[model samples]
Target: MVDGATTGLFLDAAGMKALGAAIAIAITGYASAIAEKDIGTAAIGAMAENEGLFGKGLILTVIPETIVIFGLVVALLINSA
Candidate 1:
């Protein structure tokens, strides 16, 4: 059992854990979005120069998506703990 009086901010251990998980996901998701935007811009330029480069550009643009996936995994781990 936990005491409410001890946690003046109203968040207990579980609440803190949830907050931590959320922060992890939010920050990583934001970072991934920024990375995707930059990569997508460059990829679009490359594709414009050579249409055949579309596939490679697409793959490069999507690589940043892994950051979000990692973030989700981290959130899951944090929440589970």
Candidate 2:
């Protein structure tokens, strides 16, 4: 009986950790999307004003993508733990 109870508790904890990792990834992805939206808008405006600014605008637009990459790394760490 004691073993069963301990096993159940361990499963519960593991489930919680999995859920937390999923939430972290989802929230960060959403935030990155929001940031990308604004950055894309600004980049478009800048590009319209000066065609030569395309490279800079592209870099700025892609910067927010790092948030998703970091989120994936964190999720992997959480799951590993």
> Cα RMSD for candidate 1?
2.2
Question: Distance from true position, residue 61, model 2, in Å?
Answer: 0.8
Models 1 onward score TM values of: 0.85, 0.79
List CA RMSD, all candidates: 2.2, 2.9
Candidate 1 lowest-lDDT run of ten: 1-10
Regions more than 4 Å wrong, model 1: 1-8
Note the residue pairs that clash in candidate 1. none
Number of the predicted model whose TM-score against the real structure is largest: 1
Error of 2 at 78 (Å): 0.8
Best by lDDT: 1
Candidate 2 lDDT over 10-78, as tens digits, reads: 566677788879998999899899999999999999999999999999999989999989999999999
